[model samples]
Target: MPFTPITAEQRFVLDHVVRVRELAATERFAAASDDVIDAVLEGVGAFAAGEWAPLLRAGDTVGARWTPEGVRMPDGYAEAYHDYVDGGWGTIGVPEAHGGQGLPFAIQTAVLDTLGTANMAFALCPTLTVGAIEALAHHGSAEQQRLYLPHLATGAWTGTMNLTEPQAGSDVGALRTTATPLGDGTWRIKGTKIFISFGDHDMAENIVHLVLARTPDAPVGTKGISLFLVPKFRLDEDGRPGAANDVRVVSIEHKMGLHASPTCVLSFGDHDDCVGELIGPEHGGMRAMFTMMNNARLNVGLQGVQAAEAATQAAVAYALERVQSARAGGTSRDAVRIVEHPDVRRMLMRMKAQTQAARALVYYAAGQVDRAGSGDARARGRLELVTPLAKAHGTDLGNEVASLGIQVHGGMGYIEETGAAQFFRDVRITSIYEGTNGIQAADLVGRKLALGREASGGGVFAELIADMRDEAQDARLIALIDACEATGQALADASTDDRLAASYPFLTMVSVATCGWLMERQGRAATDDAPFMRMKRACVRFYLEQIVPEALGLVAAAQAPADVLYAVEAELFAE
Candidate 1:
């Protein structure tokens, strides 16, 4: 029931996507090669094993406590945070100017999985900090960056994205928090933002809130929304904490999981004389915030993979040690461990394969981000196109793999103490937060595929299909390729009409297809001696038999006409 490290299967799939090695003698990764990435992977694995692994049960058992000033974290949470920061794990992906290691995004993702798997609640504090750095880098004024970036990158003060209100979940257009712009540069903001992470805490001196509120004279809906930098404690020119900012943690939520992470009900403008400054241009806040959104979505996908990987390894270990029923050909006198049975072996195999496939897909997306943002034009174009798919598909892989992990544990999974339930609960939020799977799929259909269609999209997909065909010499890879082709065709056949109704199911098929495709590629690309290659082959076979059938139905449903979505018989239920 304990969380574990990357399985053989995960390493194999991700290997296809990332080039791992130790860092070179040279200090920087800008001119550095795979060695930097390799050392990063090793460092992450070591950190998870040595530090974070032992904290899983403790994090859950002693979740954060609420007090009059703010919520207090676990006993050793602060020390752990310091370890991660002092070790430079927190700033690996950011630029050098902001105290970041400034390594490749792919390497950063590889390391993030380790932290997430160790303790999602504890991992979250810094995860949000990284996102804040990304946002501030993109939108913060020069002065703001100088004041905040250094502190945030060093984890001196954490940051939170305040976009969600009670009335405004997905619909930012409905946001009503008013940012009253003063005659001077600053403004007095007043509104409540719920579900704000690290909103009020003693963990750091100041909290830089990237709050979303409407300007008084602004237009209604999303157009009126703007980004404001409201610190928990105002900073002086030397960057020391000064007067208190208006934002406060009125109360924290008692949630299903990640209890260690205080989900605060934050009051932004409750106090008059609450000082705030605009991040980017007025009313352009939503546009600027997307930097964080895109980054967050990718991290969430990694979380999905991390949870599944940890759960998969734990389940396998449990199956290895825990004695259960007798083997198929064995007598009642000799009961075998769960690992000895085909069905149990099959379950373990499924978990391993899915986790690996997901890891590969998420890592692949990280590579694309580097390429897309790089100076290379082709890399940029291809990355923009694949971003949504990576986020959506990776998350789907996470959920499916975690579900298998739970099922593998049988009754033990249903119990909270076993820890599989925590993974299940934590993973649920991946698809919900960082933009729902539906939103991700919509992004794929509306942005990636649509743009692909316009900009030689057919050729892009054709090349993808052709790549599989090119590698069709291998029998196992061929079968995976075929399954992927089937799923992709079904997805291509979908339109906006029925999508609203069957969106979840339809996107589920796409995710399966995408991961299956990657599995095939990883298998084709792997060496015979690699355990991951063998794991990929096993998952490819299992997915073909079990998960592919679901895709068939999803495809059939996606093939339905748009109007059919509303053809439901609600009256039948009433009767």
Candidate 2:
């Protein structure tokens, strides 16, 4: 099957759902005129489809190989990456001052959406680098920015966020990575960071690691943690990658998918000389790291969109070509394309609708980021509220759609040769990383909900519901919005145990309603009734009629008492 960049879909989302024109209207993003935006979408789409798509099969099969020297990427990856850099794809969202195109973040996300759909494992390299650029742009000292931001913004050097340790999986407070201040401005970073993606790759000349560590006199927990800029190679006076830093790839994880992305166990200062500069103030690591993490979270959500898009494309192509049985109710007895069958049609429609919904959700969030960057306080709060939804539910949709893609393929999907299974394996990690989807749910109820309240009198969540109410005319969407409101209010008064228990379901209800709202808006925008518009209208109809109603059942789950969840004794679970 062939993989084409969802260029038309992305353009539609940007034009209608995300409204990139509004971003262009802002003085900061004035350069992102319609012409420039379209060119970017078309150019990146062509580059991704022509350059990266070819590497997808080999990325899964050959993967990235590791040795003492470094992790060698799949063949043609270096050349493709060079072209990616040379083509200026990585510079879309970076600031003009940093040698970039200075476009809206949503446009950059569009680039990743296309490329990741082509080759997700390969796309992870630039994803983390974008996060690093953001972190440095926000928190790094002026000298640090001058020294590093240019190379990073240009994609000459890649970046990695090193937060995970063997024991500190989700608990950042438990990390034991130590950063001792030298008499000079730098510090010695020592500890092992596990599951560092693109931690050591040959794609760039140097890797800038944003590491989280604690100082000698710092307090315990995340409050005491600090962020460090630890590069693979120390820069000389001229700011080029000079001597090798003490960071070493202990080994890369042999994972279920994304094999081409080397998930590394990195040993920093193994010989006791890894040098790093403090990114922000002492004991401000968590705050600084969040700058990077927040950026990555949205990109991770986009990864979900990427996977969904890829899987949907493959499954749809497969459904149209594979002959199976006659239609459920048809005149001919002869076998027809599987797509003619009602059940397969159902599966294909679900995949397409869900993929579009997820893409809209992510693009909407990216639009909020751009607005927030342009000094929209309301958009900032909205961005905060929607980030988790986009990260968790978007990825959740990815997993669900990928699984459905496999089901649509029947048994051929079970075998690796058909290439349907790779989407599932690669996307499975999206829900688990950046912060597990469960953790994202917890953050939604525990933090974002309250923050939204503080930021606005009724809070951003309420504002979202209000926006949906204003935009939506469908009764199903309206009903879901009402249910979301009820659950949100109830959870606000609930106990910690209750809140956590209902968090996942509540997140789902809110996500589906929000996506449904966006889908309705997209439906309204497609009034011309062209073939694409008709299909858009159809998918929106299916989503509201079939998918939106599913959220109704979750209302009970979202309001379920926590006692039932804890009723059974934990010790007897093994029985």
TM per candidate comes to 0.90, 0.99
Candidate 1 lDDT at 506 equals 51
lDDT of 1 by residue, 304-389 (tens): 88778777877887788889878876666588888888888877877777676677767777766665555555555556555566
Model-by-model lDDT, in order?
A: 0.72, 0.93
Cα TM-score of candidate 2: 0.99
Tell me the tens digit of each residue's lDDT in model 2 across 395-509.
9999999999999999999999999999999999999999999999999999888775764689888898899999899999999999999899999999999999999999999
- In candidate 1, residue 531 scores what lDDT? 61
Q: List the residue pairs that clash in candidate 1.
A: 21-38, 22-35, 23-35, 23-36, 190-269, 191-269, 452-457
Measured with C-alpha atoms, the lDDT of residue 131 in candidate 2 is 97
The candidate that wins on lDDT is 2
Off by over 4 Å in 1: 1-4, 7-15, 19-32, 331-333, 457-495, 528-537, 540-553, 568-575
Task: State how far residue 537 of model 2 sits from its true place (Å).
Answer: 0.9
